[model samples]
Target: MSKIWGRILWPLAGFGSFVLVWYLVAVSGVMPPGQLPRPDEVVGTLATQFRDDDLLLDVRLSVLRVLIGVAVGCSLALPVGFLLAWYTPLRQMFDPLFSFFRALPPIALIPLVIIYLGIGEQARLFILIYAAFFASVVVIYEGIASTDEIYVRAARSMGASEMELFRRVIVPLAVPQVLVAVRVAVGVCWATLVAAELIAAQRGLGASIQDAANFFQIEMVYGGVVLIGLSALVMDRLLAVVMKRAVRWQDRVGG
Candidate 1:
């Protein structure tokens, strides 16, 4: 169908344009040799790396770390966000603290994390969790807080108790927000991965990138960066699919 072709062609066209621009810039001699690799060079490095087992291992470890971080962080955030949304006093009491911590970059806490948890998996997870938690909690709290009061009043007028109202009305309305929070948390965790892996990580895309950079392997560095981006894009698309299905009942403007 024309619509299907349009959908497919548009993305391909965009990528094609980007690659063309990149090729032009690479050949422009703007940067020093080996500093900026052409797209083909990066692709070649990726293809070669794909033939090796280490790349797969790195990918698995990085994905696993992100998955675990998002799971734990979002789980903890849900209750905390709900409490903040539901209780005015609690929101007032903890809002400042949340804001303060949220303003602190996860990388800035690396030394403290290393000192407290040691340069181990725990420290890495802590950094990822910290990033994911703050990224999600704010969205979750705002989503719940911004729910339509008309729906709440209607439910109450129908003799719905607080618990029932929350379970049937508030929670359903907040489902979209919860899914969005997960997506945001996933993105934040990926962005913080390099920082997390700085804690003496043995294997991960971030660790591999660091290793490549140490050896002045420019192509490998580009490949690692590309892989990280592709991995994040895949995860985000999967989350988007889940979100679409989960919130299918909600009215929207278009597909």
Candidate 2:
């Protein structure tokens, strides 16, 4: 616990310093209010524009989309990655397609997705899946490929069947990397949602920012930006906690 606190304190201190700098910059009058609202002003606008009910609703909506997208992406990617790693011919078949699509930015697909799916939740979900799939598949595939060959060989020597070797040896070895991949996917997937929302429809932090921009609500815009950053930080930290617990055996071995 002390160690965790120590780790957290460092980032907290850095964040505090950042906030101080932002406040100084805003108060120094180097920029016009229209350009950069003061932190306090942004906070005030956040309170005024955000009713208690809708604030939570907006947060929930964005989080729900992120969860759904990441879930679908991981569901597909993990199995696909494992199969590709286990079967060379399968890997050869899909590797080029994966590489091509992974290289394409999720934002680049938004227009086409919107045209096909229209301005609906599906469009947003599509971008999220694209973002999460590419990122997770790369990590998962690498993880599987890098799974210690010694373990697989040892398992075979012990007369373990192929399925048993995969389940008991390979998966256990690859799980640490899979967890890390999920962490990376969380960020990528959420970011893609922002771009997806910007192009299309109705509600979301991205849409909120766009609306604020159109109305010249500079403080609201800043508030939205700040909220998004804070949300991501919180989610990452929560995932870190989960990761630490999930990978405790690995840590113990290293320790």
Candidate 3:
């Protein structure tokens, strides 16, 4: 459809340009094929990878891990962020701890997590969850906290109860920001999932890329890297559509 292509044209053009530049550079002998695979060779490798029975399985498993972690992180973040923002005492008690944990990288905890949780799917899921939770909780909390006090005051002046003010005034305003946080959380989860898979997983894309490196399959490695970027782009576009739908007024204003 024209509308769909309109939305994607710029990104597609950019990607095409990137490939053109990469190919030109490689073909120019600036980087040998042994160092940087040609774009067409990478595409060929990707086509071959797609034909493999395990590629889809690996993608599915990685997506499953990301989804599980997103679910866990969001489930905890929403209620906790809301509670912390709503109650001063609770906010004081937890905010510093949240800040502390947020400062620590998920990769920093990978070794300890692997030691305690084992090199299983649980450890991978946990790492993703941890990263997503840290990144999301602060965003959501700030989103809630940043709700206009004027709106709350106006609602209260209209005899709205605290719950009503929060439900009707604060939450609706915060939802857009919260969704952005979720989008960011998704990206963090993907990165952490890849890091987790780099160590223990046998069939994940990251592991496949690592294997390709070991075997000197530069094309496969390039293809795997391209797949990861493409997957992220697809997800980001999907989320952008959802965000536009949810915040149509914002889009109208921006446009």
Candidate 4:
């Protein structure tokens, strides 16, 4: 029970401290009025927005987009990552291209994406998918590559076939890495949401934030930012739980 309380209280205390600092900054008169609204004002805005149908729709749309993008992106990445790890020649051939694209920010490709895919759902999805795929593929490849050679040697000494080695030995060991890749991809997709929605989105948390900023509705902007953070945090926590259960066999220092 105490351990549970410690876990809850530590995070709550951190949030409280952050709110206190925000309150101090708001009262410091550093920025002009209507620029930095009080924490209370943002909270009120969030409460009011929560009851708004349009805001609810935006939440639903944003969640759907992220889900779809991560699903498609990570699904494709899994096979590609395995191939890259398994085939040294293929990895060498594509490594430079992967590195080049990985270094390119999704936002930087907005113009090209707009010109090619147009300012539509396809454009938005492309950005999200691009962000997720690169973010996950590297982790998956590394995880597979790092698998202990001793395990492979032991299985081979037992006369395990190539198919048996991969299916029974390699795949099981790589499961943790796959889970980690999904988590990384999910985080990247959420972080890229604003950029993805910048392509003329009609409804989404990112779109709402952009609209509010245009009107200088500071409280609404803060509310939207809070919503995005909280949404991402919730999803991350859920994924953490899934990961913990999925990788129970994994040994680590703390465990």
Q: Candidate 3 or 4, higher lDDT? A: 4
Rate residue 170 of model 2 by lDDT. Answer: 86
The ten-residue window of minimal lDDT in model 3 covers: 246-255
Model 2: residue 222 alpha-carbon error in angstroms: 1.5
How accurate locally, in lDDT, is each candidate? 0.90, 0.81, 0.81, 0.89
Candidate achieving the largest TM-score: 1
RMSD of each: 1.5, 2.2, 2.4, 1.7
lDDT, candidate 3, 1-255, per-residue tens: 886676678768988999899988888988754898789988887787879645777777777777788889987898888888888799999899999999998888888998899988788888888888888998888878877789988999999998898888888887787788888888888777668786588887778788888899888888877777777767777887788788887643111
Q: What digit string (tens of lDDT, one per residue) describes model 2 on residues 1-255?
A: 887767878778898898889889988989975687777898888887676526656667778888888888888899988988888888888889999998899988877887898877888888898898898998898778877788889999999999999889888888777777787888997777679777665778888888889999888788888877778778878888887877788863221
Where in model 3 is the C-alpha error above 4 Å? 1-6, 250-255
Rate residue 132 of model 1 by lDDT. Answer: 89
User: Distance (Å) between predicted and true CA of 57, model 3?
Assistant: 1.6
On a 0 to 100 scale, what is the lDDT of residue 156 in model 3?
Answer: 91
Worst 10 residues of 1 by lDDT: 246-255
User: What TM-score, over all chains together, does every model reach?
Assistant: 0.96, 0.92, 0.91, 0.95
| Clashing pairs for predicted structure model 2, backbone only | none
